[model samples]
Target: MTPSTSTNLTRIVKFGKKPAKRDARNLKLSAILKAPPRLPAEYDFDVQHNGIPTPMFGNDYHGDCVIAGRAHQTLRFEDAEQKKILPITETDVLKEWHLENGGTEDGVYVLDSIKLWRTKGWKAAGKVYKIKAFAEIDRKNHDEVKSTVYADIGTGLGFSLPDSAMTEFNAGKPWALTTKPPNKKNGHYVYVPGYTKIGPVCVTWGRKQQMNWAFFDKYCDEAYAMIDAADTKKKKSILDGKKIDEFLTKLKK
Candidate 1:
């Protein structure tokens, strides 16, 4: 397809509730979607330099792709989270998930978490992901604002792409895939490490996955990228997982 064509940016990650003011995020991403894509390349989320490597974390069966995805994003930078980048454990992801939802088997929801964290400066399920310090990469009217949660790339600490889905970019490969009937396990929220010759590279489950321009055209629905704000800190909020189950139960009444 040519660079001017528009593609759907819808998603498959389920949310019990919907989000607000998603127009700007979606519209900006649509333009990105229309941009020309590069081709024939490989990406490693580990950020290797010639041979040296950086470690990353993976997900578990209980549905923590969102957490794993966020963790991988942090590992992309040398000093993400205001400290040295390290492999963020799935347990770290799970612990924060508990704090956010009280550990009630909520799985992962991209829209609600992203809008709150990326645009409104709320904490991600994992405390390590401080949306407060990160800025939204793109917005419809970003320059008009004097001071805002979102900013240009140079100023933001790290950016996040919200409301995207994981679809099968290639068939019969080790790479994960999401289809129209959408594989239940494949649907996910991923961290955009950056673009590649193929298209955008998402760090998912501790590995790099490519969504080429054509793949994005067919499966990509919505997205937002958060950039680092001017300030950066390694401090992370902490939460206890054991109490999460009990806390959520108490709220039911």
Candidate 2:
């Protein structure tokens, strides 16, 4: 029996893979792992923008939060008027980049993942997975570029959560995170498509999770604003010819 198109449409997301490495910068972010990070009280504002509609994906057994977040950014950007926002296959993230060391059940790396995007691109879901890639969305400081980037491009925000692993574990929602995961083992990452009634709506595990304005303000340490390639004139790739080795050297301490 042939699988219905609708059944295939729901297969965009998969279980998350664990984080690959723990870097000094990430550890620093994790050190301040108190629940409900302190922030200004009056700043109870929420903002939202456009994004692709991806479903709640699970890592199942692997720790691939990095890939999951990247998938969110990639799929949402690629989501054109298709029935599904992110129409892709599991092999895209799982199998394609084996020889180049593109993926791992252990985890995904920020710079390494960039290399994968540059080298192999990504697999688009259809009758068969199609090769597709997007222009690099320059990594800019949220404070410096947030004004220009937010509500514009769907991007990635890297931050560490408090002791809310259990919260995330049960609810399948991740909010207030950092590049350096707070737990010391997991460097959690999420896709920030846009804001909500009170705060930014984060994407993970098929859920468009929204966090409190204060929580987002305090834990959001590092942010990378991503725009669809066609949306901005920044056509040139930011990570041109850069090697992941350089980032690895810095991550290891």
Candidate 3:
């Protein structure tokens, strides 16, 4: 496929809802449909380093292959009393699931307890994980409430695609139009195709913490010493679990 050829992209549209045994399961379904006519041209850069080029339909420069645009998506769910909309990133979704299902609640939710047990009479191959957390204020019996649930399965965190997903993405991975504005937390910035100053959000992880030596050797040492000289001095958790209190106490001597 050439960059100029038109390609089809799927979109989900919710029509109605269906019955489910669980109240949460009784949710709406979205039908995957073809996008509307007169869509914007999609454009992605083909520049690559030493890695092998990703799979593509045709020449990398075709407008038909590119679907460059902005998208603003909002996720809504009922929280006992009212609808709650949480704007989250792809990573935030995983964190949210862990918060909702795991014993250790996130900043928003507080963990109550967790139980783990085997099902078989003897040596069972799998174990069950059960967890409970504090309910929202609007939930029934909010002050005195408890829920027991189980997931009879194996759960683990794994990694794939050794290289960056951005590399694959820029190599003409067909995507949807996004209206989300770029934020500084995304790390890097780039101007949009038509919108002169509008930039997109992009971030990467797995980096080591580095200190600012020049600034560290400046105004901080004296003030730090004075603070450490106090009677109620306590250790601080620094990089890689190093403590500052012990070091400071020794320095004061």
Task: Give each prediction's root-mean-square deviation over alpha carbons.
Answer: 13.3, 10.9, 24.5
Q: Candidate 2, residues 1-253: lDDT per residue as tens digits?
A: 1101111323332222233333333212111112222232222112222444554434433445556676666665454324245555455544543322444444444545644554456554533222222222223323322321232344565544554633553555544443333543434568765554456566765566766555665554455443343223221222221232343355557
TM-score (C-alpha) between model 3 and the true structure? 0.16
Q: Which consecutive 10 residues in model 3 have the weakest lDDT in total?
A: 64-73
RMSD of model 2, in Å?
10.9
Please provide TM-scores, in order, for all candidate models, with all chains considered together: 0.50, 0.54, 0.16
lDDT of 2 at 171: 50
Model 1 agreement with the true structure over 74-188: per-residue lDDT tens digits: 4444343344545455567566555545566555455555544454432323443444222233423322111111112211111222223322322213222334342333344
Residue 214 deviation, candidate 3, in Å?
A: 43
> Whole-model lDDT for model 2 versus the true structure?
0.43
lDDT of 3 at 230: 16
Judging by lDDT against the true structure, name the best candidate.
Answer: 2
Give lDDT tens digits, candidate 3, residues 45-112. 11111121122211122111110000001111111112332222333323333333342221111111
Q: How many clashing pairs in candidate 3?
A: 16
